[model samples]
Target: MNDQKFVDAVFFELFDENFCRYQDSLTKPTTGEQDSYGRARNALALLNSAQRLDVVEFLRVVIADTASVILGALDGVHFPDGLEGECVVSLDGVEIQGDLQDMFLSKAQNLGIYD
Candidate 1:
């Protein structure tokens, strides 16, 4: 798939499946409520645990396609604990830098994944 198509697919999986539902679960009327950071973190965690090849591949593609916007969104965002160790994009068993995790979270937030 092309870059944009791959990015869209990954996002569709995020929003259409577990990510949106997970955000809903985290919401509490009494509390001030969480933001896209939690939603993105949990979603990435789930994707990482699944070890889906398509997701990893598309992530690489989208990194080139959308890095600037994602990077811009990264400012002041708090990464989830252990995020550096848990989620990743690897090619031939070689893990890319932890920046990919931040990229993923930023993309999700920019897309309004929690909404």
Candidate 2:
């Protein structure tokens, strides 16, 4: 993937965690939603720039192979057969291991990233 798309995926990954973390408090007609939204926006803006490479380094150290798998999936790159189920996604300290496509889609749906 290109650097821009890589940055975007990293930003979205962080945004998804923040959304899930604050979803309950982010109700309508309340400041909580605004707070969370602002945080998410700030996070994306900050991470979308030069700081993205640092974030990538952090991911490489913390998540290792999982990071590459996620980015690959987001970029529509298919993995070898039978390897899909080896993928593991970690969100906010919770880890889910399953088929790469299935896990990615389900996580994105839960984060309201897809219709």
Candidate 3:
């Protein structure tokens, strides 16, 4: 799928499956062991986990296809072992919400991933 379609896909996924039901006190968790608050937090976390630049090509940021958005929600992130939790699109000034301004550089240098 095209890039715009990809981003929009992710947004729709968050909106349809989880966001709409987030206010409920008994909604199921996105991940295991998540309570009501955790479930709600997962919904935001899933959307926030998406890299803004990945789907920000041309003047598009969201796709017109609903299925595309649904599929895009599965795109999780994985930063390098030594880096921080936020994944960087690029090493220099080319980052986006995934760290458009280096949110973890200071700690990234001193961090260690045991996994």
TM-score of every prediction relative to native = 0.27, 0.22, 0.26
**Candidate 3 structure quality by residue, lDDT tens digits, 1-115:** 2333333444445444443454342233355546656655554445533432222221122222232322222222333345444332322353233321122221222322111
User: Which residue ranges in model 1 land beyond 4 Å of their true spot?
Assistant: 1-12, 19-89
Best-fitting candidate, measured by TM-score? 1
**Candidate 3 segments exceeding 4 Å error:** 25-81, 84-115
Better of 1 and 3 by TM-score: 1
Model 1: how far residue 98 lies from native, Å: 1.5
User: Least accurate stretch of 10 residues (summed lDDT) in model 3?
Assistant: 106-115
RMSD of each: 14.7, 14.0, 16.6
What TM-score does prediction 1 earn? Answer: 0.27
The backbone clash count of each candidate, in order, is 0, 0, 2
Considering lDDT, which of the candidate structures 1 and 3 is the better prediction for this target?
1
lDDT of 1 by residue, 8-100 (tens): 555567555644464444332223334664544545555533453344334434543354444223322334444342334444455443354
Q: List the residue pairs that clash in candidate 3.
A: 9-68, 9-69
* TM-score, predicted candidate 3 vs. hidden true structure: 0.26
